[model samples]
Target: MPVSSPQIINMGCRLNLAEGESIRALLAGRDTIVINSCAVTNEAVKQTRQAIRRARREKPDAELVVTGCAAQIDPASFAAMPEVNRVIGNAEKLKSEAWEAYDAVLVQDIMAVRETAPHLAASFSTHARAFVEVQNGCDHRCTFCAIPYGRGNSRSVPAGAVIDRVAALAANHGEVVLTGVDLTSYGPDLPGSPSLGQLVERILHHVPQLRRLRLSSLDGVEIDDRLFALLTQEPRLQPHVHLSLQAGDDMVLKRMKRRHGRAESVALVERLRAARPEIAIGADLIAGFPTEDEAMFANTRALIDDCDIVHAHIFPYSPRAGTPAARMPQVEPAIVKARAARLREAAAARRSRWLQSLIGSAQQVLVERPGDRGHAGNFAEVRVPPSETGEIVTVTIKAVQEGKLIA
Candidate 1:
């Protein structure tokens, strides 16, 4: 295949975006169409297929390549697709040599790989802010999750390498978001087994020019004391924290094999708020889990008010094959969809109330692009006058319209 400009269609978490950037950098000026797929849910898999078809239709001459969790889990399924010419695994996708010698499907068992290398991207093509991958994979086996099978074991990039990458990005990018499969599970694989907080401290110490540092989704139970202290002391660290609180009910959490309970999650939120009064909190909540009754669902609904979760990513339970939850007593599809909608409604109300509170407050908005739409330190969407794409500017909240802060 003649080397031409590569087109990458990335779907899924911040970590995927970060990996896609690296893949883009590796396949620069190549005539390849890479569809980075996600298998987080059945819908995600369907979306990946849709994206592949769309990519093929748009660029008929381009060579289609598939990779990421979806492809990693089911390589043969993607390979059988007529639109796809090649399928690669999660680990293989990061290697330059894999792309260099890309002729056939090359996917290996992810579990066999023990170490994670820091795959640094020259720049990000999708967003203004740069996401640096600090860790990869998961060690925990949540009953509902099939991610560990695709992503393999938890592994961390050495803290020094991470600091270097952050420093490099700090030179050009105002904000650097640290991303990973299991972000809070970082550093357990390293030699000293330094904590995520230690890595944050190193980045702060080394990269003084970096304006803001943000974190991707974190497991509440994995948060160390050092990180909690930083939450209180560090102003450069973004005030918003998105926790991976899958369920709010204690029994449901136990069924999910999650580490944190309802009380623990609530206490963590309260502690974070006490440390930083203006801090905004977000969470990932599942609407209908296996064996969840009306009372259990009500606990999840009440958690929105209890935790003050203004921003939420609510997912209705979808049983993935090979997971323990797939064999459990299932919630009806209609009930799941309805519960998801209700959860979304509740989240919107909480978000509206939070935005209303911020109506008269001054905010520092990081301009994502020229249209004056950007995100505040607390991850609230803000609209202001036109500014430089990557510049951070101060704006006063004038009103809330259409669920966004207007300045």
Candidate 2:
């Protein structure tokens, strides 16, 4: 099948979608479909292959290109597939020359990459809010993570570039989310090593028109003093914070090579809530980690209530190849699935309670689509009467249905 333009299938974090926007611009008018893959979990890898197969079935004659974490980690695997014509590395995919050539597999040593240049996208296709990648790669080697191999050491985009991108997108998008592999670790590689808080302060100070600013998932240990100050004082910065809290048990956290302990995680949440009572906390929790006993799992369950985490992403541990966690004693698949379900259940209950609390409160929602369902600054999903897409409006919450606030 002949295609008019490159079709990009982005998988994984907001960062990938942000990168996809840049890739879309570079491959404009080209007869190809690029699969920007994620290799965070075994299931993610499976989905990447499934997507490639589906793409091939739909567009049999179109040149198929694969890139991103999954392709970067295992380029040969993607290249070996009959459906994929070429496999580009994560670094290569960003370079204009790599996409321009668009002929053979172009995987490179991602670990050697020392700096990350900002890829500015005019707007986002998936989200009403624009995602500007402020940082790339991870310096900390978590036991279960394979992302460091895919995205090199921690490197930050210059604050000036990020501000410019946010300023550009602000014209079209009301909200801009600062996305990265490790957002809190941003700016350590740059000159004078400015902190993430400093970057955010610069953006808000420079771009007054940008209505809202949000940060993607952050590490509990890395919340700088300036960022904490902003969280309490700045209304423009969204009140929703998603933490990378892998496990709630101290032992499990240690095994995962996390910087913060279970107590530290709880304390951080407490501090954030104290600073801004309206702030909605979200977290990523891993269930059934290797060597995690029932007691350890219980600690994780208790953490949900202790931290008041309304929005939680519970992942049943899927051991990845070459990761330290994979080599450890594995948890039974059934047990893993069960624990994950319980965590989800707890999270649902918390979310329901949170929605119920907002029933009578007035909220400013940025309309994501036509039907009036948009997220508030606190990241609560509010459904209102028919409204224009991308318009921010204040509505009084009236009722709750299926965990969504009705306005």
Q: Could you estimate the TM-score for every candidate?
A: 0.98, 0.97
Model 2 residue 41 distance off true place after TM-score fit, in angstroms: 0.5
Q: Evaluate model 2: give its TM-score.
A: 0.97
Instruction: Tell me the spans in candidate 2 whose CA falls farther than 4 Å from its real position.
Output: 1-3
Best by TM-score: 1
Q: Write the per-residue lDDT of candidate 2 for residues 1-407, one digit (tens) a residue.
A: 65588899999888899999999988888888999999999999999999999999999999899999999999888999999899999998888999778567898899999878545776686678898999999999999999999998999999989988889898888799999999999987889999999999999999999999999999978997999999878999999999999899999999999989989989899999998999999999999999999999999998999999998989899999999999999999999999999999998998898889998898999999765799999999999888877789899999998788899
lDDT of 1 by residue, 1-407 (tens): 65588888889898888889899888888889999999999999999999999999999988899999999999999999999999999999999889877566899999998877557777865576999999988989999999998899998899888888888888778799999989999986788889999999999998999999999998988898999988767999999999999888999999999988999999999999998998899999998899999999999999999999998999999899999999999999999999999999999999999999998899998888765799999999999899888888999999999999999
- Tell me the lDDT of model 2 at 149: 94
Which regions of candidate 1 are displaced past 4 Å? 1-3
- Determine which window of 10 residues in candidate 1 has minimal summed lDDT: 117-126
lDDT score, candidate 2, position 25: 83
The whole-model lDDT of each prediction reads 0.91, 0.91
